[model samples]
Structure formats: C-alpha cells, structure tokens
Target: MTQAAADPRYGAAPPPRRRWRLSWNDPRTRNLAVQAAAIAVVAAAVWYLAGNAGRNLAARHIATGFAFLHRVAGIPIAEQPIPYDPATSTFARALLEGVLNTLKVSLAGIVLATILGTFVGIARLAPNWLLSRLAAVYVEVLRDIPLLLQLLFWYTLLQTLPAPRQAVHLGPAFLSNRGLRLPGLVWQPAHSWAALAALAGVVLSVLWARRARARQDATGVRPPVWPVAVALIIGLPVAVWAVLGAPLGFDVPVRKGFGFAGGVTVSPEYAALLAGLVIYTAAYVAEIVRSGIEAVPRGQWEAAGALGLRRGAILRMIVLPQALRVIIPPMTSEYLNLTKNSSLAVAIGYQDIVSIASTTLNQTGQAIEGIAIIMAVYLVISLTISLFMNWYNARVALVER
Candidate 1:
C-alpha cells in the first residue's frame, strides 16, 4: 500500500451542518416562539379595543381626554378629607379628596376590626360558657348577613339620631344626626417638637425591642419590653409637652346656633360606612384568628403547661408563633375584602373613591378616564397591603435549614 494507506489516513470531510430550523424541533425555541405569539395576540387585541373605543367616543361627541380633570367639577361633594368646593376646585382635586377619604376609612377599619376580631376570636376559645356562646353568636350573625344590608342599617340608625342642637354628648365626644363630633387637637407650635420627640422614642423603642429579642435568644431570658415601649412612646411625649408648657389644646365641638361649630366632624354617612365595614369585616377576621389558634396542636399547649408556663404565656409565645404561620395568609385576604367592600360606600353616599369617580364620570362623560383612575387607586392600595403582609409572612414562616 502507498504511504497514505500505510498510515491509515484517507481523504476525510466534515458533514455539512443542517440549516437551522425554527420549529418545535428545538424545544426551547418552540416554547419561546409560542410565548411571543401569545404576547402579539394580546397586544393586537388591546390595540383593536383602543381604536374602537376612540371611534365610538367620537361618534357620541363625548370628550375622552383627561384635560377635563383640570376643569371645575361643578358637582357638590358633602364630605371631604380636605376642604373642597366644587365651585372653586378642579375635578383633579375632587378625585384626590375621594382617594383620601377611601384610604382614611380603610385604614381605620383595618385597625378597629383587627382589635375587635382578636378579642372575639379568643372569646370563641374561652372556657367560660357565656363568652364562647356569645362569640359564636356574633360570628354567625355578622358573617351570615349581607354586608350591604348592614351598611344600610347602620346608615339608617345614624340618620335617626337627633339634630346637632340636641346632640348626644359624652365627655369630649358628641353624636347627632349631623355627625359624630370629637374633640380634635389644636396644634400649638411646640406640638411639632413633641411629635418629633415621639417619633424618636418610637425608633428607640423598636431598636430596644430587637436588642431584647436577641438577648433572649442568646441567654434564654426575655425581659418585658412592653413597659419600656409604653414609657418611651407615651411618657416621652408627655415629658416633651410638659417641658414646652403643655401647650396641649383641644377644639371641642360645641352647639353653636343651628349646628356644632368647632371640632372634627365625622359625617353620619362616614360614621355608618366605617361602622359597617368594621363590623362586617371583623366577623371574618374572628373566624380566621380562631382557626389559626386552633391549628396549633393540643400537645404543644400541654407541653408548655407541663414546663410551668402560664396559660397566657403559652398562648402568646408558643401558640401564636405557630398559629401566625397559618393565620397571616387568611388574615391578608380578610383585609383585602374589607378594602374592596369599602366601595359599597357609594350605595349609602359615603363619597369613597368609587362614588366620587362615578360622579366625575357622569359630569365629565369621561368614563374611561374615571374608571381607570378608580382602578389604579384600588390596585395601588391592595398591592401595598399585600406586600407588607407578604414581608411579615416571610419573617414569621418556619425556616428549615
């Protein structure tokens, strides 16, 4: 054989690379192509809807732009967080006031409901026959009734009260068909400094709490931090006020002429809305809390008891820590429900975001803009609450190494 054959080397060539194909032959590329197609379809549908809306709007001669938001609202609003005169203020300001009103009631309702629910939930588990029965009745009654009926009932009840001249007075608070008037703070120059001092005290209290928790983790000894926190929060603020000559003052609502003149007024509509939201929401929260508490095994409680821990301590330390892991997810849903239910304020004329936005839509004939604004406001609020709860859930969740 020749030298090439003796070396076992022959003419060799690499196979020609196949032309790249863009189909499911490659799983990844196919998946990406499918997703791209889906996105394109969605985008096209949105564009079509937009164009159709514009044409219909033009045919109807209804103005579609948000420029109308700058024009005078020309509609009366009975309740507002900030002073708003429709004759004087722009529609934008009116809408903003509505958003603020919605937020005010929502935040207040959450706090009150939470506190009320916690008590009712604990009462459900109470050994005393009367307490548990009462709790059960409350939960069943409130939960079974329609929230709309509750709202209307409360509104009717508030409207039946006597007028401002014959207002029911209780200490610094007054109630009447006109509204519930509460003594409001009359801010003095020193109050600003006092507020700052109070804020500082809260920061210090949080820091001290973390330190105490860390110390307990290391040494198995937990110092009571609640007393110190209370002192720092309440006592420090009081001390600051005293140092500044206690310039604390109040604007007490007094019967003046035909109506109360001084103090913060919670309109009857607002009062009913808040009361209804709190009561309706608390029932569900109570159930969630009770279920969370019960989720903890009996063995855990018995073990804690055997270890010489008081019932209260066991409930607080061992049971709650475990129960919270179950509670937070459902509790978050209840909060969201309360927020959405606040929209029912419109039915009773409470002037929430949805109510005001509906008025704006009618007056301006800008349905799209008004609806969009309402949706955006609610989305932002719901997301904020969800994010905070999610972060807290993550912190409390069991961490397995």
Candidate 2:
C-alpha cells in the first residue's frame, strides 16, 4: 500500500461539514422565534394601551399620575392598625394601613387554617367511624359552597349576636355583635425589649437545631434541642422582662354604655372576614394534607411497626419527613389563595387594600393610579410568598447521593 494510505492521518478526504441553517422544522429555533414574537406583541399592546389611556385622561381633564397619593384622604377607616387621622393623614398612609390590615388577616388565616386543617386531615384517617365521617362531611360541604356566600352567611350570623351589654363572657374575652373583645397587654418598653430578645432567641434556637441535625447525621448520637431552645426562647425573654421590672399589666375590657373600652377590639367586619377565610381555606388544606399522608407506602408503616416503634413515633420520625416533600408545594398554593381571597374583605366592610383603594380612587379621581397600587401590592405579596415557599420546598426536597 502507498505510504499515504498506510497512515490513518492520510485517510480519504474528511466529509464536508454541514452548514448551519435555521428552520421552522428545528424545535429549539422555532420555540425561540415564537417566544420573541409573542413577547414583542405583548409589549406593543401594553405601550399602545397605556398611551391611549393617558391621552384620553388628558382630554377628559382627569389626572394621570400618583400625585393624588400625597393628597389628604378624608376616608374614615373603621380599623386602623396604626394611628390614622382622616383629616390629617395622606392617601399613602391610609393605603399603608390597608396593607397592614390585609397582612394581619392573611397571615393569621394561614396559621389558623394550617393547624385546623392538619387536625381535620388526621381525623379523616382516624379509626373511629363517626369522627372520620364528620371530618369527611366537613371537607366536602365547605369545599362545595361558594366562599362569597359563606362570608355573607358568617357576617349575617355575627350580626344576630347579642349587643355589648348582653355579651357572652368567656374568661377575659367577650363576644357580642360589636365583635370579640379580648384582654390585651398594656404594652411598654420592657415588653418591646423582651419581644426582641425572644425573636433573637428563636433565631439562635433554629441555628442550634440545624447544627444538632448535622452532628446527628455525621455521628450517631443526637443532642437535645428543647432544653436549649426553652432557655433561649422563654428564659431569655423572662430574664429581659425581669431586668426591666417585669411590667405585666393587662388591659381588661370594661363595658361603659353601648360599647367596651380599654381592651383590644376585633371589629365585626374583621371577625366575619377572618371566620369566612379560615373556614373556607382550611377545607382545601385538609384535603392536601390527607393526600400527602396517604402517599406514604403501607410497607413503610409496617416496617416501622415491626421494629417495635409506636404508631405516633413511626409517623413523627419516619413518615412525616417523606410526606413533607409532597405537602409543601400544594400548601404554598393554598397560602397564596388565602392571601388573594382576602381582597373579598371589601364585600364585608373590612378595610383591606382593595377596599381602601376603591374609596381612594372615588375620592381622588385617580382611577388608574388606585387600581395600579392595588395590583402592584398584591403582585409583590404573591411573589414574595412564592419565593419563600420555593426556597423552603428546595430545602425539604429529596437528595440522592
């Protein structure tokens, strides 16, 4: 054989390289082209609509910016988380109060709903026939009913309660048509310091718990967390309070003539809204929890039991950790739903962001700006919840080594 043919480096001329060509047939190229076109169309539409709205508002002698937010808002809000004088407060402050009120209801609803729903979910799987049946009925009925109707029903029901003079007494709390009046703390500087200390303790306890878990994973023995947690979380706060003279004053409610004074007053509108949202949202959360628990294999339960583990211990240690991976994603959605559903407070007279925004627009005639504020507030809230939940989901997700 010739010298050139004998060597692989001198093999027949290499096949010509195929020139790159874009085509609709290529999935990646097609997808990018389609996405770009769609984005451009959306951008153009938004720009044109905004310009048209501005021009029309100008022609009709209406204002178009957020300048109205600084103007005096004489809107009387019944429930203000912070001090607000309608005559003196600006529209921005009023809106901020609205935001706080919304957060109060939404956060409380999420917490209460989670606790109640988890119990209901467990009850649905109980051995007792009656308890399981009752739980099932609750989930089915609540899920089927319209949330608006429930809100209306609860509001009407609360309206029928006896007046403050004839309020039902339960310990330091009173229930009346006015609303629930609960004993409150006469807050002071010492309490504030103690609260800060308690918060700091919580952060420290969480860090310790994480470190303990890591130690347990590396070694065989797990360190006790409760003792340290209690000392930091409870003892630290108590010590702080003691150092500041231990001001433990209570603001007890007392009836004057028609209404009560001196205690924390929960308005009827807030009571109705919270009752409606918590009860309605809990039903769905129950179903999600139930499904997550059932997703654990029967064999895992049997194996744990065979190893002489109690049912509760098996659940707490072995099953729940796995079940959480399934539970968190759906739970995040429920939280978001509860937050958004709070907008319905407008119907019940609760001065949430949406309700306050509507009143603000009517008074100031900044229709676009008011609506934009409401939209922006909810968008930010939703995104924040999503990001936190996503981060937590990633933390609890299964990892294979």
The CA lDDT at 287 in model 2 is 92
What's the lDDT of the predicted structure labeled candidate 1?
A: 0.91
Highest-scoring model, lDDT: 2
* Tens digit of per-residue lDDT, candidate 2, span 1-401: 58879899879698886554598787777899999999999999999999999999999999778888888899998999999999999999999999999999999999999999988988898789999999999999999999999999999999999998999998989999999999999999999999999999999999999999999999978999999999999999999999999988899999887788879988889989999999999999999989988999989999999999998899889888888899999999999999999999999899999999999999888899999999999999999999999999999999976
> In model 2, what lDDT does residue 28 have?
74
For each candidate, the alpha-carbon lDDT, in order, equals 0.91, 0.93
For residues 1-401, what per-residue lDDT tens digits would candidate 1 score against the true structure? 46765563454455676666776897777889999999999999999999999999999898888899889987888877798997899999999999999999999999999999988998999899999999999999999999999999999998999887788888978888988889999989788888888999999899999999999999999988999999998889889989989986799988888888889988988889999999989988889889999999999999999999998899899998999999899999888889999999998998989999999999877899999999999999999999999999999999987
Residue 107 of model 1 has an lDDT of: 95
Identify the runs in model 2 with alpha carbons over 4 angstroms from their true place. 1-35, 214-219
